[model samples]
Target: MKFTEEHEWLRPEDDVIVVGITQHAATQLGDIVFVELPEVGTEVTKDDEVVVIESVKAASDILAPLDGEIVEINEALPDNPALVNEDPQGEAWFFKIRPSEPQQMDEYMDEAGYLALIS
Candidate 1:
């Protein structure tokens, strides 16, 4: 997985890439209450606001870390938003995309780099 400065994370899964906010972002957001994801067929560019996560503190956009076409979304979010806080990097993932430029994944930060960035 890779992380973006905007706090979004990307994990490769076969031909698609899973995307979500980092654990740090979930912590900063407080308790997540709702999530808004783009439609399955939507096309997005790097840094595009593809998802919106609403927390007790505030609502924040979860940007796309790479250009891609949305292929799927976590249907469980609306009914169970806290999953974002409970497992931001796991079952809480927001969406999946078929990347337009897979190489862009390497341009983002690694786990250690992301940790240093937050620190």
Candidate 2:
């Protein structure tokens, strides 16, 4: 998993990269109530806002960590937003992207770097 300074995480799977907020971001957001995800095929540049996660605290935007076309969205989130606070790095993933520049992964933070940032 690669992490962005904004707290989004990217996990490459086969030919796509899964996108989600990190546990730290979810924790800070409080209980998530809604998630607005873009349709499949939506193109986004690196750092572009792709989804909005609403919580008791405030609405937060989840940005694309790399340039890509969105391929899939987690359809279950609108009904079960707490999945984000419950399992942020897994079932709570917001979407998957088919990257235009896979090499951009190298620019994201590794686990140790992400942990250090939040600490």
Candidate 3:
């Protein structure tokens, strides 16, 4: 999966969605401190405001990757914000959503494309 200029990534599986910050975003965020995720069953639209990530420098809003119903939230972030900084591409992910609009994925940049922009 790639990312958006806003620093969100979308991994759309068969019936689930995985959302996370890109490595580029993690680098920019610095030391993560806290996270605010929407509750399960919340209805969200494409690019909706859904999460709040606090870093040593400031807090950033984590936008929804697609229009979907929030199926699950990563409750783990409240205590281990460092995970976002330590491994943004792995376990540090924000949540899993059942995407309602898969076509929005086309709006995001591919890994290579996003890397170029950040580079």
Candidate 4:
């Protein structure tokens, strides 16, 4: 798993990459109430605003960490947004993307670095 400065996490799974916000991000958001996910098959570039999350505190955008095609989104989020707060790095993952440039993942930090960043 790799983590971005924006608090997004990416886990390579088979041929795709699973993407989601870190536990730190979910805690900061403060009780997510809504989620707007990108449609599957949509093309995205690095830093593109792909998912919108609304919480009691504020609404935030989840950016694409790499150029890729959004192959699947977690359909459960729209109905149960609180899942983000419940299991941010697990079942609450936002989407799976097929990266056009898989090597771009190397630019992200490891778990230790991410922990240091949050600390």
Best candidate, lDDT:
4
In candidate 1 the C-alpha lDDT for residue 18 amounts to 91
- Residue 21's lDDT within candidate 4 is 97
Q: Write the per-residue lDDT of candidate 4 for residues 28-93, one digit (tens) a residue.
A: 989999999999999999999999999988889999999999999999999999999999999999
Candidate 1, residues 12-36: lDDT per residue as tens digits?
A: 9999999888889889999999888
What tens digits encode model 3's per-residue C-alpha lDDT throughout 23-63? 88899888999898899999999768899999989988988
Per-residue lDDT for 103 in model 4?
Answer: 98
Task: Tell me each candidate's TM-score.
Answer: 0.95, 0.96, 0.93, 0.99
Off by over 4 Å in 3: none
Give the lowest summed-lDDT range of ten residues in model 3: 8-17
Q: After superposition, how far is residue 35 of candidate 1 from its true place, in Å?
A: 0.6
Q: Which ten residues in a row have the lowest lDDT in candidate 4?
A: 56-65
**Better-scoring candidate (lDDT), 2 or 3:** 2
lDDT pick, better of 2 and 4? 4
As a TM-score, model 3 comes out at 0.93
Better of 3 and 4 by TM-score: 4
Better model by lDDT, 1 or 4?
4
**How far is 26's C-alpha from truth in model 2 (Å)?**
0.7
Candidate 3 residue pairs in backbone clash: none
